[model samples]
Target: MKLLLVVSNYPYEGHPYSGAFNERSALALRRLGHEVEVLAPRPYVPRGLSRLASRWSSYASIPEHETRAEIAVYRPAYAQLPLLGGALWSESCAYAVSAGEIARRHRRAPYDAILSFGLIGAGGIGWRLGRRLAVPAAGWATGNDVRVAPRSSFGKAVRRSLEKIDLVFYQSAELRACGAALLNVAPDEMDARRHAVLPRGVEEPPVLSSERRHELRRAVGLGEEQVVVLYLGRIAAPKGVFELAQAMARARERCPELICWMVGAKRGFDDSAKLARCGSVRLIDACAHEQIWDYFAAADIFAFPSHGEGMPNSLLEAMSTGLPAVAYAIPPIEEIDQGSGALLRVAPGDVHGLADALVSLARTPERRAALGRNGRARVYAAFLSADRMASAARRVAQLIETRGVSFSQFADRSAAAVRR
Candidate 1:
């Protein structure tokens, strides 16, 4: 099946981590024997060559179009105001840019369905593009779209876009419910069947052998005797980094061998100093995209105290690497971490509870091994494997094909029902 994926934020020149999850999904779909193209909009700042111009010159220089990972990707320029609801504005510009590409692609072969990520911006763009092309559009909801948007500046606009889309894909059950509340359409209009509850996939990372693990540890000057705990995402508030630090500070009293290898950064900012006071925590600088797997391999356990998440991709990666995790028993986190017995989850903000859990896990290496194995098995059996995600995508394509040239009938009736 041929697809046109529209996203507002995607990995571009000099930005390695941006929209990486979306890019991986695209590649996974292609691996399943489908053709995919990307339409990612870049922020444009028009100025009289001022300081902003000097700062954003790299964005303008980003290649307008490039084909990477065996997929054709296009980055169109969209003028945006950062602070105040730029997402809505980006969609309008994206629609204009996407229409031309859709037309060009349609001439070669019509896409089975249009796929868009990020419900706030790209969802509207995909809905508009689908309307123009008279095809079904599926919006993938993640992070800010479900969590931040409803409470943000453009709540109603986001809701309207969700209402208009033919289908919605949510990475977690929490997000699915959050979307319904945010969209707030009547039962008759918000058809649950139209939403696909598909968590993002875990592409098998480079398998780290026991020898490789030792090599990575030695390279980082970590002694073979120490227990390395890893926090994969941003080192910021809400991620509970400070709380994790406190937890470590307490846990170290019980097991002084515990050393946290803080990897990744907050928007590429290394506030490693935040955890400086924690004697047991080691502030490792953010690694390159390719170097992440080595950190996972080098670590003995994954500790994520994040208060919230949209499926926790980093957690998934760590789990797939066969590392036992200790995180919060929060929604979505609990959804993934529960029942498997692979994770030890404490209450959301209980530092002592978190510390106790970590110390217990650290002391019991046999239990850790058992949990790690179970976590890896869970990822392979139920979570997002490449084939699982591809299969979900294929099902959506099949649905669109059977639904015929347009999903306008469904959209119209739902809108009317919502109105009445």
Candidate 2:
């Protein structure tokens, strides 16, 4: 089947770390013998505006089109309004731009279905484009689209999109429940039939021998006795970056050999001042996605104290590299844990608990080794297996072939039947 993925964030030349999972999904679908293409709308800002903000300049620099990882990615320019943060107006502009490009492609060789990576921008764009092109469309909710966006000013818009989308794929069951709640439907209702829980998978990393790990640690300026705790993601409050920093500071007092390495883009949230003050905490800027595995190999523990998540790719990647994780006991993380002891869990915002967990893992080498092995096994069995992506692709193909009406339309018909 031929499919078009409408995504707001996609890895580009300059921002290779952005949307790494989306890239992986597209590649996986292609490997399953499906023709997949990506349409990611790049924000367009005038040169004058670009001069004012380096962010805008970076956006302006993205080429109109590029083939990333051997997959065709079309990036059309969409005007970005200042302070709008890609809200309704930005989405409208993106839709207008993407619809035209997709229409041309559809005329040449029609796509089977359109899939959006998230709801706010890409989902709406995909639904609208699918309607205009007479194709089925589905939405994949990755965290914020369900939990955060619905409570913001985009609530009604999101509900409307949720109703109109043919199917909704959530990264976790908890996120699926959140999406159902947004639509005001019970778990066993029409929402259940129209939605699925499909977690993203991580590619297996090269096996790191003890010698290789020790070499990597030495390359990164780590002593043989030092313990490394790694965090890779955006440096933001919601990601618990500040909390991780504070926890590291507290943990170091107990385990003097402990070192914390926070590697990610600051984006808008700058925790440099806070992280700088914390001794033994190293803030490394985000690097290429391919280079991330080395950091995981050199680290003994992965710390992700995020406040919320929809199946984090970093956590999966870390675990895939045989790194035991320490994260908050949020619903998504708990779902991943499933009492498997694959990761050590702490209460959300419990800096002391987080610190203690880190210290305990640092002090107990045998427990760390056991948890790392368990984490790697869990990741492979649950997420890295080929069956996961193949099943997802088969479901998408089924949706394309069988699902024609939107979820809301089906719900309305069911309601009328009950009334009759």
Q: CA lDDT of each candidate?
A: 0.76, 0.81
Cα deviation at 316, candidate 1, in Å, is 1.0
How do the residues 1-420 of candidate 2 rate in per-residue lDDT, one tens digit apiece? 888998888887777877778888888788878899999898888778677766678887788888877789998998876666546654678888777667778878888888888887888888887777766788888888887556665666677778888778889988888877887887567456568888867777776778878888777678879999999988777899888888988999889999989898554435555666666678888888778988888888999999999988899899988898999999988888898888899999999999999999999999998998889888988887355678767777787666455444444443343233
Residue 383, model 2: Cα distance from true site in angstroms: 1.2
Q: What TM-score would you give candidate 1 relative to the actual structure?
A: 0.89
The digit string of per-residue lDDT tens for model 1 on 289-384 reads: 677888888888899898888888888889988999888988877778668776777899999999998889888899889989988887777676
In candidate 2, the residue pairs with backbone N, CA or C atoms under 3 Å apart (3 or more residues apart, or in different chains) clash, namely: none
Shift of residue 367 alpha carbon in model 1, Å: 1.2
| Candidate 1 off by > 4 Å | 47-58, 149-153, 185-190, 266-280, 408-420
Return the TM-score for each candidate structure. 0.89, 0.91
**Number of clashes in every candidate structure?**
0, 0
Model 1, residue 217: distance off in Å is: 1.7
Name model 2 segments beyond 4 Å from true: 149-153, 266-270, 403-420
